[model samples]
Target: MHSTNAPASRILVTGVGANPGFGLTRSLTRLGHTVIAADARPHAPGFLLPTVIPQVIPLAADPQYSDVLEKVCRDLAVDAVVAGIEHDLVPLVDMRPRLKATGVRVWLPDAESVHACIDKAAFHAVLTANGIPCPRTWLPEQIDEIPDGVELVVKPARGHGAQGVHFVNRREHARVLCELVPAALVQERLYGHEFTADCLVDRDGVASVILRRRDLVKAGLAAVSTTFDDPVVRDLVVRTLNAVRARGVCCVQGFVSDDGAVAITELNMRIAGGFPLTEAAGADLVGQMVNGLFGLPVDHGRLTYETGKVLTNYVETLAVGDAEAPQRNGHSRPVASPAVQVRPDARRNASPFLYGAETAAVGRVLRSGQYGHTDVTEEFEQRVARFLGVPDAVAVASGTAALHTALLAAGIGPGDEVIVPSLTFCATIQAILATGATPRFVDIDPATLCVTDTLIMDAVTDSTAAVVPVLFGGRAVDLSAVRDELQERGIAVVEDAAHAFGSRTPDGRRVGATGALTCFSFGPIKNLTCGQGGMVIPRSPQEADRVRRMRLLGVVQSQDERANTTTYRVDGFGLRYQLSGINAAIGLAQLDHFATTANERRRLWRAYRDALTGLDGITLVDVGEDATPHLCQVLVPDRDKVFAALRGQGIGVGVHYPPNHLQPAFATWHRGTLPATEQVGEQILSLPFHQHLTDNDIEHVVSVLAAALDASGGTS
Candidate 1:
């Protein structure tokens, strides 16, 4: 191992997908230092290197770049950072102060110097001002002024490597290319031998330069290179470095003309791609860089290298496996998460109404390079808690996860019975089953299609561990009279408020604020769409902690906490039910415009109510005024025939649910017949109800419903 004056550090190296970064990572690890290999692409070869920690980060241009980098540095306890590519140089320089404040060391030139080196036009100006010979350059607007018969290179002013670099012998071709390339510039093509100087400038302003000839070049990289001694190239490179006020590890490339004149071409503010030759030739470049990075004096003498040593590189696959092998692995729910499910178009079908800000929010979260439960998810949780006036809200992957997590946190397990109505979605039953609790199906009050306190108490047995009151169609269920008795009997109240997000309880408090273990679905068709997510409002801080731990696979420590240490503890059973930042971002956006959504949904529900008034043989299921209606349901005589006729007439009608207790999956839990729930199940028909529906749409739907009822003989 290459010994150093100081102990090895845990260094983060960006741009590890490229050769320079890939080589730098291996070299640092060889020197007994830990390397965090970071790249924008997940399949970057450096990620597969043994003993190197792989990290996929947002692209440097992403707005969240600095924040994500800072979090990575902090979480991994990184001591220093080194840029192996030019793309990372500007961002790293901009983040230098924040990184330093967080105790992560970064050695970079000032912003002005970095900008000057990266911008081709600026590089040319600096060189010319310093009396150094270089190519004549012109911006795109100056294309017409180019002299005839001169070969030209058209490239981006702020380009790197050979990307967007095109060569042409004619001015017309150059002009056409300048229009095609963004931030394009033209430079006079030079003819001669190309050379790159691997350079390190000490804090004392002294410099050591290693010169290497591009013996065999390919794709802007020196595929084969031999180190050489040349005073003309060395002096010019040093002059160019000093001209731009460059500091730390950098490189200068130029050409040695046939007449022995040296033209400084470009300067890069990072390690050279072929610097492996410098190390092979006995230079302590990286070691001295480490010294300069830690505020220690650089030993310039050790930066010296022997001449005529050669290094060559060839293409070879580092790994071959499934491209999706690097997926974010976690325990996903047995049911598909909402984010992946297809959603209906708002204009054409009953569907979620996007407030136009959701895409931008999701994009921002995606660029943050974190998908799992994070600060974004936490922000969503806090916002929801504030909206509901609750102590805390736990966000999970889906609505089923919310119910499952809440039930588990409430101590509902095997041998316990949960009293729930049979008139709700199958997801409710599945969540109860997932917790290993038996569901005691109960009858609902036909008027509200929600279970009554009397029905709940009548079904409650000595074995009843909890009572899950499903808020059907955004209508709240009031069980206050029996709540004391249920508590006395040690039965917890876990509310399945999937459709009652903005509804109020009997006491006029928000449904989730009534001190019950309430769950809300931010699914695609809910009052608020999180693109498919759920929230659990815990009644106590202890319950919140239980759900939090259970969502991330029983890990006591959070994702951030686990990053700082080498190991973590699993406190109990759990699943991969954590809400991803992507979904949380969507939820945050929806919450911001929830008031407008509530108003529109209420207006549409009223429109349907007015149109259905005095309609024969149809009874409107009441969702109280305090509720933000999620569905417009009516019990019609001959419901099956009317439902089919409405579908045939394109009215977008559906059955709320079949009695869950009678379904094949829940047959074992069937406790005889729930007469009211059974009647509602057969008669209940849900019309198209969403924020997108207008009075005109409702009128059209009501007219179609009237026609369908007439066609079905108008009676049961």
Candidate 2:
């Protein structure tokens, strides 16, 4: 019988198909413990392990991942959970509380430590902050600072397994690779002997490190390695582990440079793939790890190993021929199933209409290290200008920023009055107020649900500095009439084209193409979104330049400083309202697929229009030929009852506005009774809309809405 104080327990090991997880599972079982192996891939080879119970789980990014993992642990009665992969670390760290409540132990570092190890940029910062020697690193935005012909390695800042890593000698190549690599980080390529340290940290923060020289590395895995005793390397590795506050079984990798200096590369929060070499060299690594995992003392004496113990790894097929498709468990259900699962109060208010390209663009910006305003933001601005056929465009942080900057640029300030639609978003009034100008609320035309030229002309006075005609529901207003009347009276027209990005006039001119100052919103529910961003299409380059300066705290040439590290002069008033490079990247990516997305959106809107043509108690908004609807809204009776019924059936609904003039914050600004605006506010209901909604989803939503209208005693 085996004599050991470490009790045999049921352990759940994730990423079992990977070498470290697979090897760890086998070793634990050999030490007389039950192994429950889990993997996101159904056909993971670890499932073939003898006497192991295997379960398939969702990828770490899945929304249902946490629930599925908890269910697995609860069902299997797992005593401890061990993550075998780096990607699983964040999710597991988030689930630590629930797992502990179920009496399952986990051996991992704190959230900050895990992130530091996983994110290369953060790791570089941590080590550098602690006076540790590490490779010189630069974010993509700082690529221009790299010396010419310097050897560089462009890799994902949050990468694993050497995937998407590129090596080059020119700074330009690094820049090009940044576009391709996800969350790319540029570093000085290290040359010399690479080493891996198999490490174990106890609860008291004491760490044991076993040094090994990597003789040959293939595809990020050590092909040939030998255990060695180097106090210098071991000491440095321990210092790095401490810098990251790492705990339990983890790995530290670095290189002994040609200059005889050790420069740490990265630290892994889990066991090294070649840890078996340590065990072969006489260290009971896994045994001691389990001892520390279950609240027992680690035998440091057992961690000692002899020098020159070699390990050679070679790939061999563990299985041949056709393999059976493994059954997916724990929230991996088929999407094609006819039955729809509805959850109570699960109606999403608004969701970003994302495509896979958004992630790719975000990765490029992250790798470039220019999270602030940079080339990507400029590129997006240029694209928007071209698409709208405008002379220039200025991208800002939000729609309100765009409006505020545009008004300020147009010389609107205190003692000035700006005409706004009362039935529109409160942001319109807020933007005017932000410019220190009074908002003159005017009633909307009942036919268009938009402020007409007559309303603007009536609200005008000697104090009227600008007229902001809001395009409701992606529909264009009487831009020509408003522009002609307002300009003759010396009143500037700043079209609040927040909902009319793609809408055009009857003359075929895009809504933003010909306006003096057109502000477009890219908020979450807007037709096009940059997560949360906005742009201003200026009539002249001078206006664009002024808006740009105003966005960067009114610093003249501030944008130039972002491109090249240099001092800038602040000459006027400005706000820190510049859009970030990452959000701009998302916007550029969204434009790349705008054609498809716009067409799809139009198709869905048309479908809704056709289905509800004669439906009683609800009337669809009359969208013109030049209009591309951002929202499918209806004027309905018993709006609250219909909203509740639709929400109860898992359909999301929204009330566009509550009459900005009547809002508590704007109640003081309330002037005359705008009967049209008040009546429309009570009747308008915005239906769920986005690029991702399928034809089936639209049909289902319409069906629920029709039933809701009938339940409220509406004529059908």
Candidate 3:
């Protein structure tokens, strides 16, 4: 039932499949005022929202979702339409006047600013008009007029990210260039230092800024960034923002030549991708932007940040899988380890992960120096790479470090902003912050837990950098569509596939194989246990090479005998976060156990469903086609009581998470509500069913759950 009393203070956020955008959408809708989510994909994460809230309009409306988006504003009498995806932004802006005519509002950069923000050539020209120097460029339409002495760089005028930028050494590729560019540009790539700036210009035209220097870690998003107050670049940013006439959370990017001239590269007319870092650095950007856009007064000059501080992605390490247990190396009925490292019994029940292997493994590694090159480590990384069908893999210290390393290789840094989901783990947000880039926490789809396109568009600004999609145990986010959108935009995407090691999409491809940089975890709790290790799988060999060197400092690691050694030419101060040899060995052993492990999990999941399906109010996860059961999840009305009752019965149950936005450190950006996340979060619970459990164990778990539900009055 739609609320007739919905307030105008409510904002509707769309883009349900994309992570951050969905986060924003969920947060707003939870406030119980008004929010309409729309997505092109039917099963996008946002659509999975509980039926209690009005359903998200399929981006493909009844007439096709875009049309529905228009009607939603009129029907709901919504106050503002939050544009979430970049592709959706322009059209939403085009619909603005008609929406307003019906008394609804849509937040977007004006059409002119949209073109300037999205098109490389148009953006460069605008920058030049504002006296902000850009890379020397000649559009293909003006190709014959190219002057004789411009040492050549080339790019497609309409391109986004680094898609069309190329260094042309030969004239032969010129014809190849035309296919990409309606007109390509032959420019002089300058000798300049790259940096990004997160600045906000209020409706009154004031610029508040922070400049960060890109550092030594991952390339696409910064492994780390240091802030510097550069008056020159900051002023240039102001000039560029003024030229674009953008009024939201805009981030501008440019380069400083050796001669110290500042040139504008582009503008993010919406919320830039890297805004999360700003929030983590103690800046409440979402609240500020929402406040600023709605005719609220913003104090732009009141912000300040510490210089040279660093943040890193939070990490969950991997453990190598052991080969099938029965026939593996003849270590049949195992003897006890020399010293059993059990936790003091009481704390053991409170832990989520299994530390049985780790306790034994860590003690051994400290004694044996063979950590990196252990047969166990190599075997596990190789198998995981093969399982994901990726070309190569490098085991790192943890999943967070894997993301940080992938960003370092991609070259994301200071002044850059990476798009992330506020509904996801704090680790992703912190990873971008570590690189001195801003993290734009986009909204999320409540059902799929994936991000939607609408949120991505609303948050994009001139300094927008990259996009990251997290597949949380692979329920419903489709990376193929997300990849398509990002590719066309010229931005890079990195997959944070920590919880999705063995999952697949509706298409048969593995979750980590979607032509993007994917990072996986083998933490103690993952489907495949690595006491502590991670792997980065890139889409291309060049990208693979880039991440390879960046993973272990800047020095390259060739595929040679010496490549496995620790002693080498370290290029920079890299983190000592490589996976240990001991952890690797355990992972390899688990690899032998893979088929059975996965099979057991699926069978257990089905059993849980069949047994619990007859009950009322407890909703078992719907895996649709194309998903490997990772955790057995259920939604119940009285979660605390159910959880407590099960615990009392000695049947351990778990929770997937608490939304990152509500964490105390992030509370300032909470924006008042996150109904779907908070409500669903409470009802969600994971049942125990590792390979060690038997069929009888499954029955016992179901019985306990049933009794708990009945005791809690859910059956009534």
TM-score for each predicted model, relative to the true structure: 0.53, 0.54, 0.47
- Runs of candidate 2 with Cα error greater than 4 angstroms are 1-346, 561-567
Query: How many angstroms is residue 300 displaced in model 3 relative to the true structure, after the best TM-score fit?
Result: 81
- Global CA lDDT of candidate 3, please? 0.63
lDDT of 3 by residue, 1-716 (tens): 11112222546666655544554554443333334455554334554332112234544223355566766665443567766655566667777778778776655667898888777778778877877767766666565666555556666665444555676654445446756655576666565666767776776777677676555334234456666667888887878888887766666767777888877666765554344556556555555556565667665533456666555533222222332322122211111122322111111222222312334455676578665645556666678889778777878878888888888767788988787776566787777777777776666666666666666666666777787777755553664545566677767788788777777777778877767788887777677777677788877777666666666556654435456786657565466566777777667655644554565456656767777868777877665446566666788888989988888877778777667777787664455555666776778777875543434456777887888888889875
Best by lDDT: 1
Q: Where is the poorest 10-residue window by lDDT in model 1?
A: 330-339
| lDDT tens digits by residue: candidate 2, 564-605 | 865667889999999999999988877865665566567768
Candidate no. 3 TM-score:
0.47
- Measured on C-alpha atoms, candidate 1 has an lDDT of 0.85
Q: Which residue runs does candidate 1 get wrong by more than 4 Å? A: 1-349
Least lDDT summed over 10 consecutive residues: which range in candidate 2? 335-344
- For each candidate, the alpha-carbon lDDT, in order, equals 0.85, 0.82, 0.63
Residue 493 Cα positional deviation in candidate 3, in Å, after optimal superposition: 1.9
User: What lDDT does model 2 reach?
Assistant: 0.82
